[model samples]
Target chain A: MNSRKSVEWRKKAGIRAEQGDAAKGDKLQSLGRLEPLEQLESLEPREPLERLEQLESRESLQSVGTLALNVNEQPILVVDGLTLESSSGQKLVEGMSFTLRRGESIGLVGESGSGKSLTLRAVLGLLPRGVQLAAGAVQHTVSSAMVFQDPRGALDPLCPVVKQVAEVVRYRQKKGRREARAEALKLLGLLGLPESLAREDRYPNQLSGGQCQRIVIAIALACRPDILLCDEPTTALDVTMQRQIIDLIATLQQELGFAMIFVTHNLAIAAEMCSRLIVMKQGRVVEEGLALDVLTQPNDPYTQMLIEAVLPLPERAETDAGAEVEKEANERSGAEGQRIAHAEESMPNTVKKSRMEDLKEDSESQAEGGSKS
Target chain B: MSAELQMEQVKVRYGGFTALNHVTLHVPARTTLGLVGESGSGKSTLARAVAGLLVPDEGRMSLGGRPLEKRRSREQRKQIQMIFQNPDASLNPRHSVRRILSEALRFHNMTRGRVQTEQRCLELLERVRLSADSLDKYPHEFSGGQRQRIAIARALSVEPELLIADEPTSALDVSVQRSVLELFREIREELNLTVLFISHDLGVIHAVSDTVAVMRQGELLELAPKEAFFAQPQTNYGRELLAAVPKMPTASGLVR
Candidate 1:
């Protein structure tokens, strides 16, 4: 159960010959060891696993347990020999497998049609209607929640975002309506959406794409997930917003100590967010390893190609001009860093941007008070 | 000479919300102006305003130094063509590629007859890197990248002097985006068409733009030559935006 130990489960696995030790990645578990999703649905929940969660944290439904055990070394999610096919039996994902350890983040990297997303869907037991689990198993014991790629589409247009988050908090956490709303606002605020935005009963359409995404994550957080499945959650966002969301998630993960499986096509982002990288190519695991090793010394040509394809930002000369820009970027963030600093981490730029809106409202309210006086 | 797109103090409003607030921009002749901003930053509003899809409340727009009339002539309309992000929405599902390209060609009076129109359609297909045989296919038959190419071909079919590509490659996959961007570069050079390429990705902007325009909250924060802007953006917000782009850890010179 060592964190870096490679469990050589399946001898006949396709891509594990180079994975073990060299890449520091676990070999894909073969068939028959874990239960498939369909069978697990009807089967009674595991007694000790349910007791493990219940025993660990019951002071509040949202509270996570102190990880006193050597839990980080144990696998939390095992996608062992999973194969997905269409209703027409056309193979979409073939023999895909990976193990995610508790509090250890792994990234699924691949372009379109590479089955990276389908593998995530299989883990969540929410594969699309046409797709079916053709073989293998998903052995996840704890509860999980997913943050979708398109925030707008994932949300209900009719529901106010606060109400939407409260609904999940109330349903899953079984809280009172007022308490649920309060919790939702607190969660949203931690995600850097201030009370001015989160407290207002705003629908998904009224909010920006970035705001809606934060609310979506708030709802997912309300589930108190032990495993967070993010499917290209920042793909539709602008670069700045994407950075904010990635920072928010990373901070939340640190506080909550949850394992995450992040699926994205951007290798740079994957390297930034994850410690381990699993490269998928045409429905198979092409390479899996420590993120830096996979990125720096790729064993697969496709992985190497993906690293090459990452379009770098325009190179900056670290002269007086570059220093000036760095200063300017930091100076803007420092303006309101104190007010919003407590609840956030690594959110200097975005917190300032959002606080500008708060300050605008604050000045208007003060003006109204003066007029009344 | 390729036409330069000029917007002087252009303002667009949706009731109380001022989408584009007195924004001034100039896309030089035959050059691509990368309009970069987050959502609700009025990048699309500026695009729609220039394409004459929406009227700006108060502004002057001149195409190649000629003031543009609100009610443009058919030729004037043909001079500016727009390609939207989603090809599925813009390209009619019912029409074949041939019919779509031919309709535009016939409307612009760019082709002499039916045979010439067909010839022109094939050339447009080749221009966008699609096979000439793709002319017979429907939008749904092609992959997303191919469909985007078809959309680009349709935009080119009219022989427009200015191409307004609003997030043309954003809907595409990362691998596909590069090839499509190369097509945009090639077409711009070959036709000398002024391009207003709007995107949210700075990487995409760095790839295609000669001049970069950073917009936020209905204002143009900074507009500079890509080299100058990238090295040291004048505005603090622009610098923040530049800092936000993810730098690959293991890439030779990149470290965040």
Candidate 2:
């Protein structure tokens, strides 16, 4: 409900603000709760929310009801007030709304049961058994594809990895088998799969988790869909592999220009990859804003808890060697300075208390002889 | 100083592939050793070797200065315990929490009577910060984090000298992960348990471990104090892994 109001206000203000209606824009912006106009100015139509802002800009204020109809020129996908219910009438997701323009990346972030994945599944028309689209509408003008969390499960266990990718290309692009195979190899190469692995007739089980995920991405890319829905794509991956996948998706989004809605439970990952974020809880959107703003200065208590809960990196000492390593690390990765600062500020008080409590328990246990049997 | 657990030039192979290659590591009696690497990097294999589930193809492992037998004796088995990544898989679905924990206690001969066993079970659950009421519930009834806590309780039921936790918090939410990582610290201190925590997450490794071991492609890359490892990793691969971790987003304008 709050998100809907902000979306309307942002839609109106983004138009007037960009159109140089300073007085009216500032007034509307002030009414909007998420971010200031200056910050919102950086907001691009890359995410679903920004498309809504773009939608409200094109229509008269009274004609906001026609939002779904005016999707010809902009917003490839519009999900408005989409609700999901079970056969028993239990609401699984309520009033979830967002829009996706071409080449935008939005992150849906929350805890495990927050319905982030379900929302994406709903958009793909793949709701689980008994869960039905009970209310609202999902209007899309273009084809879409999905990348799942468990790549191993999403892929066919019996199919050769390249053939699986090639099948999607052959079916969707309507290319001949040989041409599709060639195109599939090229796509796999672009995704950083080696020639040896990509060319081999290897089953999904034969490849590692990272390679399987790459093949899955290749399949999603083969469809050449306008929108990509990723549901916790990197949740099953290791940190290094996760980083690779994030970098790959970002690069592909830039190169291919596909609108993306990424679902993840990690706020840090969301902050890195998505320009805008929508925080969900109990099948409802609790907060939505620029990813940086939501992560750094969250308005919702649930979001704040998520930020504080992130395990801070270990504090590095100021030794000369340490500084050298830090310098090398920073040069290799540009985000180190911000990372250190955030880690310093967001160290949880609960962690500190637990550390102290642990020490106290340690001494007490030693006094009574340790619990080692 | 004698280490609680020691591995020397350990090697393991599956079919023709080497899963662990000439790896050596040590965990002090009362400290945590955080083992980190990408998937397929032999972290899990090393944990399995330590837990006596996989006998190393070469080299020797010793606990408390005694050589570990290829087939561990019942007493030797009681000295170490493992907690797996997925709590649901590690725990039996059919058993109640009470039964799951009491079975461990009885199998290990930790308690003589039902009353004493029940008391020990309650204490174990309390140590992991779960309510005593959870004892009657099944694994599926609890949340992922709670299930993990129960898994920890079952591992502690044996009062083993060494605990091998393989990505125990990876399945949990960030908030839940913090509490579980904290619980690991508290338990390690309270019970003086030596921990070998395996994870792909560097942040979790940093939070819970005193020493850090970096593994890559079944080989040890770098092993150092937690502070040193984070500050200046010895190997390029280790540094790359550290740099690859997604940084927490700070407020805009805090830094360029």
Candidate 3:
């Protein structure tokens, strides 16, 4: 524990963590444009008068922040003393508080029923029926969208995938059919889905689990959401497919520059994509710190247990450092390029096959080079 | 009391689609054989074939050098037990844990009278580290991890020689998964049972398996001792699968 290298590493981490997200506010802008409250109000169903009428003043106050909030200067969300209770007065989430800076990513890491998902749902204003906010406030300046755990279940089976995305574009953006469809296609393409499938009109049933998830991401993006809420989004996918989805989401966040609140039970994932990590257990914050500090020098027993529980990465096949990972990147990009080039002739099948092969190749090689057994 | 499980060129086809394409594998007695593959790669189908849940179109499966027939005899059926992925789906919601465990014991004639069956059910619960109070609770009353334990308990009720677990811990949290994997390992050693453990997570497979098997598109790619397979896979496809696992960021930022 007293090694010189360890001390230097800890010192370096301390300096990095204290830097804060304040420096990155300048170049960041949400891919989804900000819309006025009145503009979004008209997009709501006319028959939802009863629901809109029931809107609490607290919600309106938050919306006001959404307007006065500038992407460059202010924090996107500030949740203060948030408490959640079930219908029978059982406290579900206790005194949760965190600030999500503009265009920065924060992860809420915990085990299931740890209230991480509940907290994310509360922020998105979509808590399951009977669970209400008991105390405190969730105030955000920008509107958000969400990606769910089960991709296929989140989508409509009866509708074509492209139509489903375009519908969200139509409603949220108030764009006409041609413009909306074009926007939807652009979003899909951004998520690494092929451009050709827009013409074929593939249904959810026809696409692979990974492709369907990309479509779901496209739907979320179509809203032009300033912040993205993701809840165990890749749990249902195959590992390689899960990797692809994670990579795709990270890339999108980079290109679009949206703020993110990613909730996951896996600490390894949280470490990869998040700058600040909040470790929650049993509806309470157990540990909150910079992701590097939390991963490398965990203070809480629960956080320590989670870090240990992650399966160690098997050794890579190539002994020379970084070559395998570099090759993996090259293969993925090459295959993705190949996928886009040959996408139209056999839209659904070809895309799935090529992507699977690409992922399978890396993992297969990884498994070979990995575990000492 | 346990025996090896062997599958020889087992082939299963549903309509025109070949679910198991001339695949062959073996789980040595008193050892675990871990199965890894992506979805639609026919790993589950192969498990079903070995369990006698579905009749394979071709090839043979044998337990301890004896043929495991397409339609197994009652004794043969009792020798191999299968655990499904979703405990909620596998366990009857309306039935109490006591009823579920007792039913399996009685079906295999593990005990005679009600008192004896109830006694055996309690033992099954104890084997999986659940308290006696859990006997009266329904599956829904238990958490995801506890429910999976109940599933494991029921699978062990018949004292099967070969255990088929299909992604049993995939539904559980990591901390819970660690305990379940431990229980499985302990049980395998104590009973000398041959286990066909399937999971997409290589970390898990690494923890339990004496040997590893890879399958893709219904075809077996490679089979080797866990060390050799992970160290230097014979086939290119096998190496690629190893490469595909999401690397856990290790301590000191040195994780693969």
- Count of backbone clashes, every candidate in sequence: 0, 2, 20
Candidate 1 CAPRI classification by DockQ: acceptable
Cα lDDT tens digits, model 1, A1-373, are: 5321221221211121111221122121111111223432233322224334543665432112222123455687788899999999899999988887766678899989999989887887777889999899988666677888999997877667787777766555556889878777777777878578644688889888888899888877766666788999999998889999998888676556667889999988888788789999889999998777788889989998788777878677677877766587698788667455433433332444576776675666556656976
Interface RMSD of 2: 4.6
The positional error of residue A280 in candidate 3, measured at the CA in angstroms, is 0.4
DockQ of every candidate structure: 0.41, 0.34, 0.33
TM-score of each candidate structure, all chains considered together: 0.82, 0.80, 0.81
lDDT of 3 by residue, B20-63 (tens): 99988888898999998888889899888888889999999999
Model 3 misplacement above 4 A = A1-72, A317-373, B254-256
Cα lDDT tens digits, model 1, B1-256, are: 5899898999999999999999988888989899998888999999999999999999999898888768988988988999999998999999999998899888778889889999888888877878888878899999898998888898888888899999988888878888888888888889999999999989889998899999999999999999998987887788788889887875353377
Looking at model 3 chain A, which ten-residue stretch has the lowest summed lDDT? A60-69
Where is model 1 more than 4 Å wrong at Cα? A1-72, A197-199, A325-373, B251-254
Residue A235 of model 1 has an lDDT of 94
Order of quality (TM-score): 1, 3, 2
- Give, for candidate 1 chain A, the lowest lDDT window spanning 10 residues: A10-19
Tell me the spans in candidate 2 whose CA falls farther than 4 Å from its real position.
A1-73, A197-199, A315-373, B1-3, B252-256
lDDT of 3 by residue, A1-373 (tens): 4454543553343222111122232212222333333433343211122223333323422210111113376677899989999999999999999888655678899998899989988887778899999999998766677888899998877778887777766655657888778878877776888778778889999999999999888887765666888888888988778878887887666545567888888887777777678999999999998777788889999999998888774564554334665687799999998676544323433344667775676455446545633
